[model samples]
Target: MRKLLLPSLIIVAASLLVIRIFYLQVIDDSFKLKSDNNAIKIKYDYPERGYIYDRNGKLLVANQASYDIMVIPRELKNTDTLEFCQLLNITKEDFIKKIEKAKIYSPRLPSVFLPQLNKSEFAAFQEKIRKFEGFYFQKRSLRDYEVDSGANIFGFITQVNEKLVAKNPYYNSGDLIGRQGVEESYEDILRGIKGVKYIQKDKYNREIGSFKEGRYDTIAVQGEDINLTIDAELQKYGEELMINKRGGIVAIEPKTGEILALVTAPSYDPSILVGRQRSKNYTKLYHDSIAKPLYDRGLLAEYPPGSPFKILTGLVALQEGVVNEQTTFMCNHGFAYAPGRFQRCHCGGGPRDLHVGIYKSCNAYFSNVYLRTIGKYKSSPYAVDVWSNHIKSFGLGQFMGYDLPTGKKGKAPTSKTYKKMYPDWGWSGKTIISNAIGQGEVLMTPIQLANMMAAVANEGYYYTPHIIKKIEGKKIDTKFTTKHVTTIDKKYFKPMISGLFDVYNLGTAAGLRVEGIDICGKTGTAENFAKIDGKRVQLKDHSIFVAFAPKDNPKIAIAILVENGGFGATIAGPIASLMIEKYLRKKITRTDLETRILNTSLQAQYAKLGGLSEDIKLELRKNDSILKSKTVIPKIKIDSTKEN
Candidate 1:
């Protein structure tokens, strides 16, 4: 009986082992993958990234072939490390460090050792790469920019970190991911699927043939092409005008909410962020604290909307039924709210109504209207809450949910915020009267201001501003197409629109009007202040302008801000006028205006600050030198604006 039991147990164990082997070989792919890893070499075929096109079908971004030296830590065998390092123009210590990092990621998987080798370096390395056991050249495409402008719009790509690799299963070590702007926002659509190939290796680790007669291979799928709303000529022109200045400009189509041009001054060429020199150039840009070239002022800079905000105050007052088009207020140089306190106005004191207030930018009139709007409610907090809600309805004091990856939600002081500010004392419209003039706690980004103008141009509503007009063979998100109505009634906008029209014809922006176009605009001078050595010091006011052209059916709505530029009419208004003329007329007959703007330099004002680093000073000096160079303004023809 004991002999029979032993034999049966042996047979049972043998049958179990056979079943396990069959299950692993036929059903469970995990074990098969492990076995394949030992005997086969896997290679990735990276797909070409999508092409980026401007609204007129002009190519903005394309791709160029580049090579990366990839390494598999576990596959490494005895080889001449010195020769490999010499061929790749890297130190032995760098090679070891990269290999250690690759092992930490996954000893069996591959990682990039050295990336973005130029054509010459790639040609030299291709002949000698076979001498290395674990290393091979992987082909990838790098961004090829067609135009020098729009660096803030089309962001660059860099390798994914360990955290990203762990979070996203789709990514492996040394994978490139978009860093910012549209590239990051549309990464999934722009970065197509990577294909894989498995090649069987013999006992000597030499590739014999396909692992399973090419059954495991996949074909790479190219990324989808995307069409941006940006106009190439308009974008280039805006960037050129913004040279030697520091600030932002954003333009949107009033009807469709499609962004036309987004410019941030002191921007570097897009090509500088590509290839082997990317890290070095990026470090330089990052450390220039004053210039902040990497910072996208259009989307991220929060500033006082200045007089451009008074337009909203007028709209809100009309909506609240506190004031009408015929309502008038008298300004004795300013509005006297308290016994001795007064909010000053730049407009010459006179009897001013809503139209005159907006056109002339009367602080006293707007303040009076704001007090009436707030006084309509019984409780001060409740009144401020109502006013806050009315302002929020226009998409202020909130993130506008733009397609770009980064933005700033500029502040709009609510009742709760005021309560925090004035904890003991109760507050009222008089306490927060600065808000009536777009000062005090009211802050907005350049894009938000542009969108607000778009809403006003549309008369009552606005489509959320967006950069992507269309993706190839796919529909855009419904959120961008949906209409967002403001708190103001449609009828109330006409008076306000008329007021804006008069601004170009007879008000603060009158001197900056364009020829043969009905340009409606508001000029603003926001007082700039900074804390230096623990003392609040006032600097030159920021020049601000918001406008829409051809008043009846507006095509473009724009917002411009120039730091340290005193009086909105001086700098921002003329720039906005030129931009409008360029977009509508397609040719600037006002070359003198364009030349003057191009030649103007604000570097001296930027240098006045005492806390800047030496690196920043050097960079500023470099830019100053470039700006001082005499460069002729070309005769930009109307044909440049033609559709491709």
Candidate 2:
């Protein structure tokens, strides 16, 4: 009996010991995980944005060191609110509101107090930051505009909004985002991978050491570099040349499709938009009505292409067999369409052939050619459709699909668009006559116009226009390398080339061609509407010029538009010549011509915005005292010519 009792007690003790071991091994894991969570903090370290460089390896956009005053609201205590407001140059009420916003973002996490403070402001803040327990200074990178220009293309970087974070899991709330232009287009490539550090904190909530002595810490990866196609020197020169003028200049290398210079006049210094003053500076620039500096005229502004459309018309007629190089029409100052309604011509009476018509830019010749070109088709509708299709193939009446963001596809009417407006029972060639002269419904961006020149220069094909040359040592999409074929044959471009060459030699543009340089150019003067005193007033003309130099083997294709500039040959033509010479020859000899065009006229400044009716202006100016307290406005000199 005694032996049996001792064996039973030993078995029970062993069973109890086994149960205790299982409790420690299995059930205690949750407690250990909680302890670890309390000891460590997870932090994301941001990577630097990629640098921007021009074709010559010159830096254009880069990063500058910026400091942000950050605060963890939950940890803040005994903070001197008045003193902090004074240091940040804000009122106490303003300071309090900012804190509320920061708290809504995250109470435990650090929120930015003062963003992008300069050296002087940061140095002062650093001295007082130690006294505030919950607040600290964090180092960040802000966009630095080196050239003080190219605001529209280079664009600006700002904090990622909640909407962006929700759409992309890769972005954090505080991360910087590209707002426009190349910056926005290449956001994924330019933004580098972020890193994380697993840190251990002491009881005081201060970092004691990295978790596992930095074993799990990830190193930050740098962003991919961006190589631009622009030439910094040429771009700056072009911008200065177009000062006080509302227009744009786009210059592209004909062979490679590299944009050498993209200039939009009345542009503000990009550097002014960085840091805490971004909102204030943006307001000042945004309210300027005369220049509309934010408007990107080079790629965004669409205008009736004017006489430059003659180049396309000439090509279409020759290709369609409606006209030949020797086809002649008599132009006796104008063509009498109806008894009193005549299409006038600046070129007087002459028996002008197709080549001569292109040289003199005779409207009568194209009006006849357009009718013949379309009438040559089996049916009138078929001719109009086919002719419009050919225009579309040249990248006109459609988005050029440039690498830049937000482009306008200047209106090219599909038969559907016209069908809605015309209620057409019977369509004829005369109905679309305005399109033959590059006016009426035909409109296009400067970039698209330049690309059209590229197609002509290539004889029948062209690459898509692009701003980014390479990213992170690799070139942009392979599609940009694909040659877009036009409907015209390569041989057909030969005779058309002669007509364009004659344009610079014996045409309207003949007077402006540089000696010893074979320049092919087309000039245009377009009419636009402006509002003044509750009435639609005929504003100054828009002068436009499109050209390619060394026409036989073209090197550059350029388009220049000067708003309110009179006569494309005088104002816009010289600017186009200067830009072409600056890019190809690397020098400008026409200083007087540049000065005369830059300081020509300012009539358009007084013209009211089209959106505002005349009655509103009267009400706004009712008080003589209010009208007299005018700010010193900048003088604008405009050239009244059709620049497309």
Candidate 3:
């Protein structure tokens, strides 16, 4: 009986083992998947990123071949550390640190050890690469900027960080991603799908052949080409004009809302943020706290909109039936909203109607109109919100929904915002009358200001501003195509536009007109304040201008802001007029104005102000010297090949 029991147990155990083996092989392939992962090597085939062109079909950005040194930590074997470090032009400590980082990322997956190798470096390394184990070269493309300007618009591409890799499975260590502007906004379209090759490996950790006869392999797809709405000539010209100044300029097509030129002063050449030296150059630019070349003031710097906002005040008043074209308000060089508080103005003094209020920029007229609008509602909160809603409908105090990745919703104080500020006693229209003249809490970016003008030019509607004009085999976003109607009725636009036209004809912007172009515009001077020694100190005012050319049939809407530039007509207004003439006539009849802009240097204004640290100030001077050395060409004629 004991012998029979032993035989029965052995038979039962064998039967169970056989069934489990059958399940592992046929019914469940989990073990096979695990085995396949261990025995197969995956290689990536990176495709070229798309080309970028301007609206005139001129090439803006292209790609050049580059290489990277990839390493898998677990596959590494001892060779000559000193020799490898020397060949790569890196210290032994750097090599060790990189290896440690790669191990921390993954022991099996590949990581970038050294990247952006030029042609000569790649050639020299390829010859002796066989001596090193676990290391190989990965081919890729780097951005080749065709033009020298537009760094703020084109943005840059860089390697993914540890956080990004862990968050997104599609990305691995050393994967490239766009960082800002159009590159970031259209990454999916610009960065095409990468191909994968699964190669079978032996137990000895050597590639044998294709895994499963190359069934898991894929071919890379090239990224789609795109056309930008920017005009290369206009963009270059704008950058040239903003050379030594610190500010921003945004130009949009009034009919289509396509961005033409976006200029941020103190910006580096787009080429500097490309290729092997990108990191070093970027670090230098990023560290300049005083002259922030990397900061996009056009989209990010939220400053008071100034007198240009009165255009909206008038339009809103007209819409709400609080004021009409002929309504008059007496101004004594300012408006006394409260007993102790007076909003000062420079429009002289008279019985100013809506026309004179706009063209002459009368403070009392707009302030009274704002008060009347607020008085229409019983609840101050509701009243403020209604006025805020009317303001918001113009796309102010909100994101412009442009194709650029970065922006700020400039503060347009809502009822809730005011409630938090004056929580105890609520608030009154007199307490916030500064909003009538674009002061107190009203702020806007240059792009937003330009978009607002575009809306005014189109008579109460605007297409959301966008940079992409066309993408290969793909449609643009519906938002850019759809029109956003303002709360103000279309009828109010004609009257307001008349006031704006008079601004160019016989008012504040009278001297800033282009010869043949009927430019309807507004001039503004926003008071500048800075935190110095833990106290707010007033600096020179920032010059601002907003305009749309050929008032009857507008084509271009532009906004410019020059930091610490005194009055609106002094700097920003001339630049706007010049930009309009250049775009429309394709030639600058005002060479005098062009020369003034080109020769003027606000470098001292920027370096001295802003409460910059001593080190940052020194760095700005050093950087300026280097920039001058590069840009200042000798009077002697040079070879055309070396002109760029």
Candidate 4:
């Protein structure tokens, strides 16, 4: 019995050993095959980005062919570092750092040595690439701005970081994405579909052939093209007008809701961000503290709307029955707020009606009207809340839902806001007296101001303001084309518009009015908080103007601002009038106007003691030089085709 038991035990142990060996060699083959596939095989693919164009079918942003030097650190062996660095025109340290970063990203995936390579760089690298392993050139497209019209509007594309990649499946490491403006708002539509290819590679990592003879390949579909509402000619003219100024301008067709011109001063050339030199140029722009050329002041700048807010107040007053078309208010050069502190009126007369109030931009008239309107709400609990809601209905103190991205919702203090600060006090009509004349925590962008003018011109109705008119050969739905109707009676706007017309024909803007055209306009001198010294002092006021042409049947509406430009009537009003004249009449009698704008220098202004900074002075000089030098003919040109 003992002998039989020993023999049985040995047989059982032998069977178990055979089973364990089979599991190790055969059952685990799938995991080993996957590991091998990941180490030796490589595939790289880039999807083509979308295109951008202007209203007239002109290309605004398009994809151009460029190369990136991709590296796989694990596969790299005994590479010619000196030759590679020399070919890329980069230092050895940079090359080593970039390679180390690539290794950190992953060994199987490709990483960038240089992005947005020009034709010359690509050519040089292509020649010496045969001697390198685990490194190759990947072809893709980078955005190219065509006419340099809208820097902020077009935005910029840059490499995707690890955080962005982890959140989104559509993007991988080393992908370019839109950072701001229209590019960001329409990223899904503008970014073309990405395609992939599966290819069989040998042990040496050489592409043998397609995995399934191109059967499992995705066909690359180009991105949808976007057509803007901007007119290149008008945009160029507006940008020219805003050259020396530190402000913004937004002009649009009231009927079509098309943006004719949108200008933000102190902007950089779009061409600088195109090729391999992008990083260097971007770094310089990023560090520039004074001019801040990269800042999109047009959409981002939030300043007091000043007298422009009176237009809305007028509409509200007329709608709420607080004031009629013939109502009048007495002005004494300054409004008595409490005692010595007065909100000054630009008007200098004793008494003025609604029409004269608009022409004179009477602060007291609007303030009285606002007080009366808020007084009706005194009996209600939701007085402040309801009043805030009424203001927001006009698209103030909130986002307007425009096509452009990252727009500011200018501050409009609510009842709750005031309540939080002074919950125990009586918050009555006089509590928010300053907001009536467009001051005291009220702020808005020039685009919003222009849209308000458009709404006024349309008699309390306007289409939503937009930069892109059409996209992908399909016109954007006219749903945004719907008109925004203000609560004011349509008849009330006629008299207000008449006063605005008188402003151009006989009042403040008379000096800048176009001949043979009925232009309606209003001006504002917005006082800023910035001071010249330790003592609180009034610096030059920001010149501001809002206007529309052919008052009976308005075609264009615009808003212009000139930072630290003194008075609105003299500086900004004329600029807007000139722009309107050029658009409506097709020419200007004052050819000197262009010359004056181009040649004007801020050196004398800055030279004043404690007036401006040295960097600002230098930047002004540089800007003036660039503008003056940008004439038809160059002073010197080296012609490679012709002999010296």
Candidate 2, which segments miss by more than 4 Å at Cα?
A: 1-39, 202-204, 338-340, 601-644
Q: For model 1, which pairs clash?
A: none
lDDT tens per residue, model 3, 222-252: 8899999999999988888887777899999
Q: Sorted on TM-score, highest at the top, how do the candidates line up? A: 1, 3, 2, 4
How many backbone overlaps does candidate 4 show? 0
- Model 4 CA RMSD to the hidden true structure, in angstroms: 9.5
Tens-place lDDT digits, model 1, residues 1-644: 98899999999999999999988888754445445366778777889999999999999999999888888888898879899888778898988898898888777778888888878999998898778888888898889999988989999988888899889987877678888988999999999898988888898877899877887789889888999999999999998888778889999999999999999887888898899988877887776555678889899888878888899899989999999999999988867898888677779989999999989899889899999989999546879888988888888999998799999999888988988999999988888888888888888999999999999999989998899988999999999999999888899999998999999888988778777899888988876556555555556667899999879899999999988777888888889999988988888977878888988877666666435446555666654322211111111111100000
> Candidate 2 has what TM-score?
0.88
User: Candidate 3 — what's its lDDT?
Assistant: 0.84
Best by TM-score: 1
TM-score of each: 0.91, 0.88, 0.90, 0.86
* Pick by TM-score: 3 or 4, better one: 3
Model 3: how far residue 224 lies from native, Å: 0.9
All candidates in order of lDDT, best leading = 3, 1, 2, 4
Candidate 4 residue spans exceeding 4 A from truth? 1-36, 39-48, 337-341, 378-387, 473-479, 531-537, 590-593, 601-644
- In model 2, the Cα lDDT at residue 30 comes to 34
**Per-residue lDDT tens digits of candidate 2, residues 259-321?**
878877657678877988887777665665544567788988888888888878878888898
